[model samples]
Target: MAVTDVTYTRHSAEAAAGLMDELCTVYADAYGQVAGEDTTVKADAFRDRATGALSARNYELVTARADGELVGFVFGYSLRQERDWFAGLDPAPEAGFTDERGGERTVVLAEIEVRKAWQGQGVGRSLHDTFLGGRLEERATLSANPDATATHALYEGWGWQRVGTKPGRPGAYYREYAVFVRRLPLLDRR
Candidate 1:
């Protein structure tokens, strides 16, 4: 299917809950099975966090729907302090670029997922464009697993350049995660 059939919208807190569920399901299907761990719990926790952030007006959840079913989503928040949704987590060095933009900034894409069935369908790209395109933030950043070469390729294809990598947790199957950054055009200027 063409991306044109996908519709993007800013989801309300209530709507975000459903979208987050789909997001988690996709992530678990993509990353959990190979790791020999159940990520349903983690996914649930992430959904709660996303909902809380949206309720607190700290982030916005953008969802893509096709045939009235949620297929992909991107969750992000405006940065206001030193710590954020991913606080205390060992972020890759390049994640630093996201913090360089002070005052009315956006920090962290808590999650972005597209169902495995929808992989390579341009749904992820559509979500990214709808979520980040024309935003006024000076820059945006994301941390992706280095082992996921396809994901790295996707981000790089979208103009997000890798700036650094961080060591992974002990015994973790993935060795390190890379941080990618992309500068956005000023909204007013655009």
Candidate 2:
């Protein structure tokens, strides 16, 4: 369905906390239980992760609402020089590629979720562009499930390049993801 009434809003971490319930609802709906994976449990994990990272430096949450209903959102944070976001990267990227100095080199795209009903109508791409377009970092990075072919294609189409692979978290057992990166100042692709 084409939604021409969508409105995009950028929220600070503090403001995002107030919309946690709404954000999680969209996330849960976007990723309904698959292979016995309960979305409630997954949503809780997402809540914990998102909550903890909300205070990270330069955190931003961009939300999309259609006719007053939340439909999608994207959130990310700048990477600190003292931390290595690609610590577990397999076949590490070329030397200096992953280096972060003064938290300006890279922005880690933590999550992007769109309601199932809003999947096609340009919501995901719009959210992605809006989020990255506002970043001041040199580049942005995100990891996609290796099995999500369509999602990967969407990112690639939006000018992201797969740099390498990163192993999933300890107990997830979902294998690895293709880490993608895109230079900053994204072109007006909308």
Candidate 3:
């Protein structure tokens, strides 16, 4: 997957509703072998979460293609006050950190990845920039495994700031992921 051969596309989560199968394939192919994880199971879970996100208010997907083949994608949705994504935080974040009264307050960037052959050459960055460039949100947030240093490095180089870390609990072991935040540029309307 050469950088010059790539093209990007944006789709509303509704328009991308039927793409779970393909998206799962991309996810498995990107994370399966390296992580020594079961591809099918991971894909299944991803499909379920993605479906839920699709039904959410303002979910979006950004895909990257190389010669019209799916090479990578980034997907997430706007965070809302009604959602309890922040409730599980151990030490908790600043007061009103999860507040989303205006709906566009923050976007929870859920996932992003590129095929192995295409990584380290800017495909991920391109996909990320393309995904976030047009957002109207005030900021963006994401949670990532604390051990995934390389992934964190990529995000840090791109301007993400670590806000805090969450600890694992019995019912929500994955809460150990570190939370990161980055302010998004507001497009001038004046």
Candidate 4:
């Protein structure tokens, strides 16, 4: 389907709640097999966090709907002193990062998911492309389960490079998932 045919737009706080649930449902379904023991709990926490982020305006939630039905979405925000999208940890004291890039250098992209039924239909790619094109960042980063080969391939196929990996929690045998980064050209000035 044409990208324009799929309506992509920013969602308001009220609309975000329902969209967040759909996002979490898709997330749990995607990661449940890999996440043990606390799948629902963790997914619910993620949903709550997404909601909070939206409510605080820290993150922008963009949803894609085809024929008026939500099919895919992305959530992210401008990087601040205390908020880093991927790691969720404060940057190192000596990291030399700042959120004051005059609206130019935003580190974002916490999560992007497309419903299973919509996979391989260019929906995910459409969302990714739209997000990158819409943001002002020089680069975007994301962490993906290393064992999620398909996901990795998708990123790589889109010209994202694998930067590094981090260890997984105990009992999660799939340790050290890969981190991907993609440098994007500045959005059009016009």
Candidate 5:
């Protein structure tokens, strides 16, 4: 099932909220295939996070569709000093590394998903690139389930570096995640 004619669209937080149901459906479809995860539980957590993200300043979302069906999406927002995305990072980076300094330094790659059938046909890459390409922030960061080998590989291949590990948010999932960072403007994404 190759999605040869997929279209990617960018949406602001408000616009994305209007299509929340469709976005969650695609998220659930993508989450359903992850090994060692409780699909229902994770999906619920994602919905909660997505809703909160909608209110974050500078929120941005990019969705990929093929044949009128949502197949994938990637979204995140500017990280402010108050956000504390790295609050629980084990063996935290040196001082000043995690500082957002009023949200001018880093943007987060909060979530990226591609339906199972569209997993490897460039849909994920397209959504990722489309979402991050326009970010004016100096860097970007994301966390992935360490066991998701293919996903980790994809991020590394796209110029992301494994920084450290962090435990999932207490109310989200009970697991450790590998943190990754990438410089912005994504110069190497070819």
Candidate 6:
């Protein structure tokens, strides 16, 4: 598809509240039918997940618009000590792989997607770059659905490499997902 026009908006977690419905629509439109779940269930889950991430420390949200209509968004937050999100990572990582204080050194790319109709035109990439480009984290990580090979390839193409695969937890909606990590460029803050 021809990508002739696009724009991006960066929002702090609290400020992004007004766009929740639109964000929900885009997320549902992209992921609603996954793993035997229906649109309503997936949409509801997205809402809950977004709500949780909104309260995270240093949370960030970025939305992409193509020709003035919402197409996609990317958002994440610094992983904190209390969460210890990486403690059980399979293969155990190489060593010293995460924030010592729980979440300070890493940013988690919690959710990102381009609407179904907007997938092939690089909207997702645009959202990703613009969202993470300014991050202060030393490392970034995400878990992609293993069944979605295209997403695996997309992450690889964007400089992320597979770190390990995470088995599905009991009763979790997620499938077995491939965990990937990337070292983000350290920007001078001084």
Error of 6 at 139 (Å): 1.2
- Clash number for model 4? 0
Candidates sorted on lDDT, descending: 2, 5, 6, 3, 4, 1
Clashing pairs in 4: none
lDDT of 1 by residue, 61-154 (tens): 7877789877777777655655442333454334554353453565466578887677788888887887787356666777787778888988
Clashing pairs in 3: none
TM-score of 1: 0.75
Off by over 4 Å in 3: 34-36, 167-175
What's the residue-level lDDT of 4 in candidate 6? 53
Ranking by TM-score: 2, 6, 3, 5, 1, 4
TM-score of 3: 0.89
Candidate that would win on lDDT? 2
- Give the residue spans of candidate 4 off by over 4 A: 1-5, 12-15, 28-39, 55-58, 84-104, 167-175, 188-190
lDDT of each: 0.67, 0.86, 0.80, 0.68, 0.85, 0.82
Poorly placed runs, candidate 5 (over 4 Å): 1-4, 33-38, 186-190
- The residue-by-residue lDDT of candidate 2 on 86-109, one tens digit each, is 877877677887678777789999
Best-performing candidate as measured by TM-score? 2
Whole-model alpha-carbon lDDT for candidate 6? 0.82
Prediction RMSDs, each to the true structure: 4.3, 3.1, 2.3, 4.6, 3.4, 2.1
How do the residues 79-133 of candidate 3 rate in per-residue lDDT, one tens digit apiece? Answer: 8877766666746777888788777788888889777677788888998898888
**Model 6 — which ten-residue stretch has the worst lDDT?**
95-104
| Candidate 6, RMSD to the unseen true structure | 2.1
